[model samples]
Target: MTMELGLLKALLNKDFYEKNRGLRCPPEIFSKDVRKIKDCLDLAMEKYKADLTTEDLQAVFHATNKTMTTATKVSYDDLFRKMQSTKAIHGEIAEDALSSLFQQYVGEQVAQMGFSFVNGEEESLEPLRRLLDDYKNDFTPSIRVDWDDISIETLMAANKQESQWKFNIPSLRKKIEGVSGGHLIMVGARPNTGKTSFHASLIAGPDGFAHQGAKCIVLCNEESYERVGARYLSAATNMTMDEVHSNVSLAAERYDTVKQNVRIKDSTNKNLSWVEAVVKHEKPDIVILDMGDKFSSKTSDKTDVYLKDASIYARNIAKQYKCAVIWMSQLSAAAEGKVFLDQSMMEGSKTGKAAESDLMVLISKNPQVEGADEQDTQRHLNIAKNKLKGGWHGVLHCDLDGDRSLYTS
Candidate 1:
């Protein structure tokens, strides 16, 4: 749209006029008809020590042209009416108008220079050099952003995990303060490190997320839904198969409590997009991806690139669905036999996967001494990365009952 009127109205503001008037813009910048009005404003700006107004400019215009005919006066009055109706474009918008005008002027000057050269009226490139030198430092960007609130009230509300879904594991809860909706938690471990059981414990064990009223969906690719569901059953009932068979009624009752809220899906060969679709359709409060790496199809690029894309997708799903996505991954062999683990030990992956995680817990256990055949129940939850409560990072000890898919502090 035509910014002529807007520019004039913007100049009425003292600060804008002072900042921009240093350009020493001539009447040539305005259209032929509006040049007269611009000249009058320039006169009024100098004459009025306080502030210039449309009425003041009108008085200046009429006073300067006392011998104008009636028709000419009417045309000028219509132009003033147009300018008056136009709302002032101040701040960034006014700056943009001025910049655009300056650019337009520069373009016309360059074009005239080229025309002069073509007609053999110019000799060297000195005119262009002078033009660039004169206007080189004229353009500048002044950006100001109103940041987000840092008030105690807002921080407490935003970082509050008290009202969120609490972790069933006591030791973990004290460290991470539990997880809220729209959180992407990455859990990595080597094979047979109770990776599946860890999620099962947090989600199906007593006072677990499901019992706490979080609608959860487990999409397993590494294992069958029936197998994963069985783990959930054991976790919910806090019983081994032998114990459950001996007391089916008690196990059934306990499992029945959290069964309705918990859902298990056999999502073999499914990608992150499929997971998103299921989450969007079911609208669950929590989603679990068994072996999250399998969700991404192998591509021509490096493993990290596609895995990074997958992790990004998973995070986006959690945020968009407003639910927590628990991504189970396998840690590399380098992390094996180590009591402490970091995000770097994630198998077939790099920082891209870890970077997307809110809380990264890599499971570790006591190394085998070769001769001893005792099963180690002790597990160390390596808090490799924590972007939650207080942002603390450390390890916490917990015992795992693999048979029942449970973890306890």
Candidate 2:
């Protein structure tokens, strides 16, 4: 017969327990109290003399439970069988446990590095990269080099069902066939040129992607949740902020419709690790990082290196999660007062353009022009780089309505 207490106590060995604190154990083994399980294991370790009888284990449990107002009621025999069965299937559980532990380790390390950088410490990411590389090399990724599973008939069927995913904006969508899987779309603009409004319109406007059943999560680091929400409401309802604030009944109705499809997070933490955690948990179809430069990274002191790493990380998130990421970036000061923008105007690094994005769009508007009418304040969406459908370069003109936060073609 298997020694149930001995095996249970061995499984809770100090090193194993420390590494896997949340390891799943049957409730009948410890009466659903983790503390009680630990106490029992401690007693077993102290009093072991080759083997423990049922009476001896019962004595330990009774002694430990005496101090508590309520005793821990566990069926010792039932627990023994459950634990034996668990041991039999330990291989599968152990594999999953190890994977979870590795992911947690990576998250904790990255989060610490981000905090250290944000605190103005000089840090090198070489060690972190090596560690991740080692972990990645352990498993060989399965690639479909041979078409043993696919047939010509199946390929034809799939082609018939294929469709491009697009934003609700007609002109922009027409210029570029909508965003697709693993796509990193970058939008850059000079200050106060309705970049935020443009992103908001994608989620809130009547024709927005959210209406097409796209679940979106917005990470707003530069603005408050209330402010973003206000803008979204105004754009979604085609009403001015003042109108929404004044009409309670209409505002509530519109908000109810908006909240169903989108989640807005206050990303003041500004750390990529936090972003990774949110993306992993929420698994949103669309992730909007409000501004690029504000995002915190492990090598934040080096602007070029940080931008490169951050862009790579963003692209990885899009691909790993099979979601489209819209990264809003700031333009260089040289882009100001210009009617057109190019790839050179991107603020931080060209690697962001070259390595990260599938599409790069620059929004240009002459905000400082004297006495320009609201209708004349035209914003141009310039397709600076298009990787999806090659050889497509052009600009789409949009009329900005600042009051309602709407952009119309």
Winning model by lDDT? 1
What does candidate 2's lDDT look like per residue over 281-348, in tens digits?
99888889987667747586767778888888888988899788889988989898887788878887
Q: Lowest lDDT 10-mer window, candidate 1?
A: 135-144
Candidate-wise lDDT, in order: 0.85, 0.70
Best by TM-score: 1
lDDT of 1: 0.85
Q: So what's the TM-score on candidate 1?
A: 0.75
lDDT of 1 by residue, 1-409 (tens): 2488788887877677777774435566679878788777777777774577777778789999999999999999888888877887888877877777876777788899999999999899999899788766764444457998999999888877533998888888887768877888999988988999999999999889999999999999998888898889999998998899999999999999789998888888888878888999999998999979999876637888888888888999988889999999998989989998988899878798998998898999999888887788999999988887778899999999999999998
- Error (Å) of candidate 2 at residue 166 is 2.0
